[model samples]
Target: MTAIQPALDGTIPTTSSYAEWVDDVRPAFVTAARSGRRFTTYEIAKEHELPEPPNPRADWGNFAQSLVRDGLIEHVDFERSSRPTGERSAVSVWRGTPAARAGRVA
Candidate 1:
């Protein structure tokens, strides 16, 4: 596991609410996306110092869903590797919308 650190300059609150966590971590997410780099939810969580979800699968699912619903981010898919199983798994890549990129309302 990578050493994860909070992005905000202030202390991270003790709140357990996912929404709160998102809000706290939004700046980091935006910064990462602005760099034109793709990252997975695990990377986001680790980079932003979010608590590891009890169930990594469901937690990332809910987080992605919430981000889409809130219009804060979107996902992009690309082929990364090929294996004998003929199965492709997606890694979530976060991107801000046009309005967001423009620093305007979405």
Candidate 2:
């Protein structure tokens, strides 16, 4: 496994709700990350039937950053979100890291 990257700016909350939500969806996110395909957060969540976070605006970005820190995924690009609540706004696309594809996890 690779050394996990530090959180970007460390602003993501460490509240129990945030932790629980990340825990709930992490395995699925890891699987997707290892799949070697690019995806927006919304696409992965919807495809994996992931539960919504307590606060969508903050939590989802936080969770994605967590995944990035864990060295499981990296931001690849941005695209218009297909999620209904997203209003077609720009969303990040991500893909697996080499370590993730090799079955390594932080």
In terms of TM-score, the best-performing candidate is 2
How does residue 7 of candidate 2 score in lDDT? 52
Candidate 2 on 39-90: residue-level lDDT in tens?
Answer: 8887876666566677877888888898888899998898888877748888
TM-score, per-candidate, Cα-based? 0.54, 0.78
lDDT of 1 by residue, 1-106 (tens): 2234444864333436666555555566566555556666656655566654445447667867776676656677645433223555645566765555655533
User: Which lDDT values do the candidates have, in the order given?
Assistant: 0.57, 0.76
- Model 2 clash pairs? none
Error (Å) of candidate 1 at residue 105 is 4.8
Candidate closest to the true structure, highest lDDT: 2
Q: When superposed on Cα atoms, how far off is each prediction in RMSD?
A: 7.4, 9.6
